[model samples]
Target: MLDFAIFAVTFVIILVGAVLYLYPSSRRASGVPGLYPTDEKDGNLQDIVNKGSLHEFLVGLHQEFGSVASFWFGGRPVVSLGSVNHLQQHINPNHTTDSFETMLKSLLGYQSGMGGGANESVMRKKLYESAISNSLKNNFSTILQVVEELVGKWSSFPEAQHIPLCSHMLGLALKTVTQLGLGERFRDDAKVISFRKNHDAIWSEVGKGYMDGSLEKSSSRKAHYETALSEMESMLLSVAKERKAQRKQSVFVDALLQSSLTERQIMEDCMVFTLAGCVITANLCIWAVHFLSTSEEAQDNLYQELQDVLGSDPVSLDKIPHLRYCQQVLNETVRTAKLTPVAARLQEVEGKVDQHVIPKETLVIYALGVVLQDADTWSAPYRFDPARFEEDSARKSFCLLGFSGNQTCPELRFAYTVATVLVSTLVRRLKLHQLQGQVAEVRSELVSSPKEETWITVSRRS
Candidate 1:
């Protein structure tokens, strides 16, 4: 889901490509009410930068123009839908693939047809689906083991010690994703640490690089990025080779092996799942724990749920789904954090929303952040209330916002499970509390990370 932000910063160029020549940026074209380009070439991109992020810009744009609004994204008139009704109309019934994955394809410059035809696409689709499905289902124990190990590590920390919440969560996510997706090689801490080091290097560069055009301006920074990327890809390639030779069909890599996807496609797919998966899982845990630390009532409720459903037993896959409140806590965290704030879809055919007529190929922004906080949809939209999810209407609203429902992305579903298991296990043994006067601001990057590391203290429960 980081694709929703990382590639989005560059989408105007990557997605539209040469379309700027076909349609002039000056023309508003449709009845959609919105802003026109302030500059001849850059469109409203400067205004977006001035407003902070695309998410923030959309917030103001929708406030001024209502649910459906248009803005210039680098010489292209892009329309954004900020209400549930608008999104319902935009939802494509037949396009079943994840919307963010399509953005990823644009980022990787991968053409679905270029690798193979319709039959091959179908096979690869099955492989992708089964890879995530069977990997999580078949390897649930492995995921639980990793979660237990992290709980074990935390249990060892001195009582009332300040824990680096962000760092520990990120490390845990990387380890879980690697071992489950590739193989047991990641069971060794050194390999996982190495991957983490290189990933940190690459992640910092890629997120900031595209945002400010620094990746291209600084040669050394770009070199380090490529080097880190190469190392990460090489590690995955080694796993792919080993899995292929063994003819293993157990996890994600093996599932991809069953398909005729080129080596490049396999690597890219692996990269997407691992990289995006890690950030999402890490941030989800960080925010969930942070939010819990600040709310004693919610913490008590969650702990009670764990006690009722799990008791003193270790977390098992069978019981994970039974932790209803646990899922709500995470859903509220995602809604509050706006982890993936914005996502866009290409208008394959001319579409209409209200009185607006969308031209073919026009980029339709989801403006998810705006809708996530819209007063009309949510009660006290800014409050961190997991209990809101207790209502069926609230759950339906979340699905309409594209965070859940039948269309939930595999990465998120995976993150939710891993996070629930880990958080459940920890809360069962220890009490979590916020540091006095300790507050952290949201970065709203790749996937809503804390602007700086957020620290918390833990003590054994009485």
Candidate 2:
């Protein structure tokens, strides 16, 4: 009740203030083609709400307005670049990881040390990126262990039993990310379950709440969301403290502990990785499994690649380069699912894209979904043909979008490694089959996921 009362009051205040501030006098800020506020106070926020998510809204927006478009975000003017040509003018993938970092922070309400000098922000980003990299490198065997355990469980299931693909993938991702990104405490199954409970509680509401302000309307939901956020933060606090006290630490933890960052900085970063890492890793695996299940040829090619490269041995770090077909399958899954549909960066200085001048501090969006499935770019763009990725042209398209190669953000790179290990193991042992009469439809939000409980049955290979 207290949570409700407080949020009710806060929501009312913001609502009233927004109405006055965004009164009918406000005008569209760009010459670029796009939407004006349907109601002056709400801008295109209502349109986004009506269309489901920003990604969906962009799909329609770009369709009507072409690749370069504008929309008001609340009262502020925002620009979206929806084509590869437009994005090439605006992106430095290396620097734009911060945009994703900011987006994650917004969705999770991770606002510790948010006010800092440029150098401090730079230092923290380097540390966070390094944390994921060092952890993956230093603890790869642990990743293998998690994959082996998951495969073992699947092997034990009765023949023809329908597996809850999303549910299991979420657990597998949670277990892998929590154990590797944090520590061995997650090796305890109970710890992983507890963490996942809180994670789901927060993620479920916040994914919509950040955009729609729905969480504040119900106090019960607010209370639960806040409670889970508190618990997750406390868990990270405990982990950080334990790392601090240890005289002997793994290279991963030691790098973080020795940093000049304040405790809150470390905690905020841990929150970013924990939440973003889990969702990305889980969804990537889910889509890859589902897509491969739907296409026997793709699965066969991936399985054959596994056999040829990793014949009679588990996937090794050195062997990843040789697993060309596996990489193609994953890349195609990313494009087909349009995983991570939208990303935005705040302009640091005034800039020009094509013919328009973007004012400093404007929110500039990368309309990744529009281009990922663009008909002009790919032949039969919606088709799930992994063979397309074999072409240097398709590969270049992926790189330009920052969805392939080293240009992808660190968390995605991390997810790719984890997915490769798990998928490689599963494909080697089981033939994944999609359930009959199930059409693929996605819920495109912060990331793309199956709109319903996606079920697949796997048969053990003789």
Candidate 3:
């Protein structure tokens, strides 16, 4: 008992000391009026690590501190930029390179090293982006085929059935990204299952290393983590080798194989997208379904738009542009759900926001949830209204954050195309409704999604 108590006290003292040591440099501006506010009341670290998820905590911080604030994350202080002007100042200039890679490494508790620099990654990045664009533009048959399979399975379910959307969407995203990223080799059921199992082992640890350090401290988890990574790397390398020897049909991996990047680099890139492409895309699809399920009017409007653009036919690439209302539903879903609630930039040099001076090497974050629901930018900010996007002005407000025209990532674009197809196909034939006596509470993991299984009953449209 005495030993355990001593350890606990030591841990708390170390934690407090670390927070004090790395507290923002502006802490010294005791009498200065220009520095951003801090949570000296010891609520700072708690807010960032709150179980309600970082998004909810950030919303509270922004509400209390206004446009700019600072909070402690362990020994590091993260500066939150909450306004449209503040967010634009960093993102608009695009000072950060490899933003996605930086986020991934930070979560994994790893550092960027040689051969992974900005310039070295440019060629591989272009190749991967071009492959996705070309595939979506010229070769969309794979996506259509996958959607057909998904619809057939859903139709086979009993009438007015309750479906667990998050699981199903994840499965759909896995099949879609795999077929696109790895090619037909993944179409093999066994191979897909093997890859998913290894992927899940790694994904289960996301955003955890930064807190518990389990990936490093726990021997069991460390071993499991290494095993999973090794299996995935071996799988990617084997496929890359086989494809290079045969010069088989073009795929994302094939494109990467021909690049000058090392095998390890290619493996890392695939791993990044494998985790990213699956979760975010799946969440977007599931959230849109949940929102539409609650609002019959939105469903009706979306169905009508679909019928006008693609009546009794599978969705095609050329038909995507004409489905304006469908696009609105998606845009509104991303905004309401706040799919990606935060983005960060590292300060290589000191910077200023308004009158405050930011110190060097600070991690500046864009609290996207706060901006997405800003009352000044979004009308009745919390209401889930698709009509808000009917005009070009709403999109111009910079409130859509990650889903906006200028802000989308490659995986987001791919997911949008997939999700638009899924929603269009299902909404035309069925009406989605939330299961009685049950509500889907948001679970803020690496991706924000339902805490419990998201159950939506689908009934055939009369």
Candidate 4:
């Protein structure tokens, strides 16, 4: 009994030692000069290590560390840059060091395979670009259809009943993106609905897993990850097979089919594309509605703009360009409520930004949430002022990282169109009301969204 007790004590000691060894340690010894010097008050390494909220913690760190601060996240050296010029230098398409597909693989749960190879990466970029160009040509009618359907359904819902705006937007986004990408509506079909539910569940679970690092350690997390991958592959395989049988060409699906990609690669690309569209589009729609509901003046101004431009006619693709205030409102929403609050990339090769030396293979995160809201860049950063985008004085301060220009998110054009249609259609027909005394709360995971089950009351505008 004494011998067993001794062994147990030794085992506990060893376990504690192992944990201490693994715990993230401060590594500020490098003393790398940053674009903005780190504030001594904000340099509490223990606070950073203890804070589990990635986005909030990062924002706080940036507040102290300046735009190009260096810090450690779980033994990984992360160089954070928030300056627009720095982002332009590093994240552009011509920048050979940035590996978008590799970053995407980490997010999408795909095994990083040969870094998508340089030639293949370029090809993928071209394919994405072509897909966007083609989607612009083909997706207008499909977007209008989705918007019309959403408006029709909301109008039919019993008046003054608080509608789950977030979920509804999510469902509508799923249907809209699927129709555009796969040429099929998956919202009502039982099999498709099940797939979407599973897909969303997987993302939610896996996002938790990634943030906590439980995905690597927990068996249940592994199972969830595998289940998500398997279910996604199964769904996509069925879709691909059907497309093959029908011999129909879809811009998204066909791009995958024709590529020399393995089955897993095709599945990863399809799932990421679909999921990205759904989350961003849905969140954008919800925020737009939320803003319009709270600001009667903004809504009235938008209604007038729509009336003059659309004038009881269905919002055509051609007229979208003329809806200037509508565009400004969406831009303001993006600025205030950034959908993708943070973006990360790894430095493949050593690079220098002024006096700061970023080593090769360093992880760099551009914290857009902080940067966009920074007082240095925006006046009245907290206010939801769409007019800021109207004046040249205010417009110069606006650096929306959504597309980020050179390394533009490929789907921005498509997402903008869908959001425009939805907003224009709804405001043209309905009077959106904020549930009395119910405030909308923002939720952040892999992407930022309104709290699930956000309720809004909608009535037809008389």
Candidate 5:
């Protein structure tokens, strides 16, 4: 209740201030090609989402309207950039635009006053980069320890034990992030459990707001959301207080605490990091296992590469790049799995991409899932062939947009380190096999995940 009250007050003040300052500039219209189709007779756009064919729908739109097209969302023009050229033009590396902030604010209903400005965003990004960089280099000890713990658990499972990959991976990711990001070790702590509950509660409500204020429309949901946010905030606040008191720390939260951001702002970042870190890393690991388990050739090649690089020695950050096949396998997993299907940027100025004129304030989106599988760029697009990435030239293609491209998020970069360590450690000892009866299918969420419970059996390789 207190959190909601504080938020409500801030929301009102920011809303009024925005109306006075930003409304005039935000009223510009973009003249783009395609609009979200609406039924002429009923004056309602077709609810294509109900059919669970959003990916097919997006492909159809691109095919029909060309690379750059527009859709109407709540009377605002959202331009979808479908091709690599369009993506490069719109999400240029030189631009200082922060797409992640735009995404969090627009999609998550984050108020502008809560860590929204360019400078604040930069501070947060710098802090994240610094923490991850330091941890990646200096904290390999912690990472290996966590991975060994995970391996022990897997090894203890009985032979042919059907392990639910998603749940297990989630736990591993949670533990890893808690240790690396928070500068604290967590092993089923009550506070950790509370944090997970809140983290899930908040994510479950994504994309549900903004429909006539639907987040607050249901009192029960509003209460639940408020409680979750409050609990998460409280947990982080306590951590922050303790970390601040003891000035000796080297974690992401410590970096954040030293920054100019307030405690609430730091909490917001911790929450975002949890979402970004845990889900993406988990999906990457799960998908890597999924593809490798099914493809004997890829598994053999990856094992050979690991052996060639490590040679019975343990995996470390220093050796990740030398294991080229492992990188290829992971890259192929990202390309085939399409964990994050789209990335969006809000156009701050009128822009021209190819022949399309994108107006100011338009939400420019990159359709990664469609482009990654584009037949023009990828041969045998649907096949899980890690060998496709064997040639550096093939990997250079812009289709792998999320992590490898110019638009790579820091979270994904951090995920690579975590995923590399886990994959290297696990595959070195255990031979993974997919359960024969269950056919894995891709399901779309905020991130992509397997539709069914992905069960894999671990057998001793040596």
Candidate 6:
């Protein structure tokens, strides 16, 4: 017993010494400024994980640590910023390609050295000039067709059958975006349906793994993510191959194939474009409906605006601009429920932000959710007021970075048109109800959603 006790005591002492030696004691030692507070004395990696929501915790960190602060994310030195001014200073078109490409590669699971920088640039330029540039104008008919199909489906739902608004909206958005990008309807098609089911399942698991800190070094999670991404790529590549064989040049796949890019690169860009547009636009529609339902006055006013402008003419593409109130409502929805809450960049060269010197290759994260909701920039930041965007004074700051500016995703114009049409169609014909026990909660990931299960009641407008 004495020998065992002695061994145990010595082991405990060695463990303590190791921890003390390994743990960072000061901000400078941690490669961060001293202004930011660290819980190094009491906190561990598990403590960081236990904090409520990752998004909320990150926001709090930025609040406590000013615009530029550092935190240890799984042993990585994560530099965070929450000001638009700071983001604008760091992320410009000239310096954003590396960070953007890194994220794209990670998301698409692309192999390095497969495509050179010059080829990637040429492909990006072709994608921008061809598919993205023509998306808004070219996809108008497709958007309308998708919206009409969705409206027709919703019109059949009786008053007793309260539709799951978010799911339906997501389905509609996914279908519309896929149809627009691929020039084929894949929403309910058997192969596409299975692909979506598997893709969503994998992403859900991956999200859980990330939040639980199990994604890092977890071979199972890594395999799951890779499989999901691979399946998505395979589906897209098959479609691209078919389109090529047919000499079809209607959608993004066609443009991608024609560009100076490999099949893998084309697949990556397609996946990014499709996923970005589908998720954000769908969530926006869901939130817009929720806001309109909760606020009767706003809904009535919006319905009146739609009626006055559209007047039962099925919301023509040309008439989208006239529905000013609908646009404001959409903008307010984006401001309140930021779809893309955080934007990240890596510093390429040493630069000074405010008084601090930021080193090269340092990861910088800008909290768009915090900045958009900052009281200094917005009045009654928590309120759902669409009228704030009606006046010219308020309109100047209306750019909420939904699609961002310098590193703006190419699909914004297409998303805007599709969202405008869908919202206008619904508001004109339907009166939505806030279902019992339905409350809006933000779900954070690559994009945001209204909690896990958000349901709203809809009835045809009299």
Question: Per-residue alpha-carbon lDDT of model 4 for 19-75, expressed as tens digits?
Answer: 223232322315553333233433333453355345566677667777777664434
lDDT of 3 at 387: 95
Give me the displacement of residue 101 in model 5, in angstroms.
Answer: 3.3
Clashes of each: 0, 0, 0, 0, 0, 0
Q: Every model's Cα RMSD, please?
A: 3.3, 6.3, 7.5, 9.8, 6.3, 10.2
66-111: candidate 1 lDDT, tens digit per residue? 9998887666788888987888777442243445555455444455
Query: Candidate 1 vs candidate 4: which has greater lDDT?
Result: 1
Any runs in candidate 4 off by more than 4 Å, and if so which?
1-29, 33-52, 85-101, 107-116, 185-188, 210-213, 216-218, 259-263, 393-406
Off by over 4 Å in 3: 1-43, 91-96, 106-118, 215-217, 399-402
Q: Report clash pairs, candidate 6.
A: none
Please, what are the lDDT tens digits per residue for candidate 5 over residues 351-436? 78876677766655667667878887788989998888867656666333545644466677777788888888888888888888
Stretch of 10 with least lDDT, candidate 1: 1-10
lDDT of 6 by residue, 122-199 (tens): 447556547865655666777788888887777778876777877888787777777777876464567557666655
Question: In candidate 3, what are the lDDT values of residues 3-73, reduced to their tens digit?
Answer: 00000101111233322333344322121122232455543555445435566776777777777877664
TM-score of model 1 (CA atoms): 0.91
TM, every model: 0.91, 0.90, 0.86, 0.83, 0.87, 0.82
TM-score quality measure for candidate 2: 0.90
> In model 1, what is the error at residue 28, expressed in angstroms?
4.6
In model 2, pairs of residues that clash are none
**For candidate 4, what is the lDDT?**
0.63
Quote model 4's TM-score.
0.83
Greater lDDT among 4 and 6 belongs to 4
Of the two candidates 5 and 6, the one with more favorable TM-score, higher being better, is: 5
Order of models, best TM-score first: 1, 2, 5, 3, 4, 6
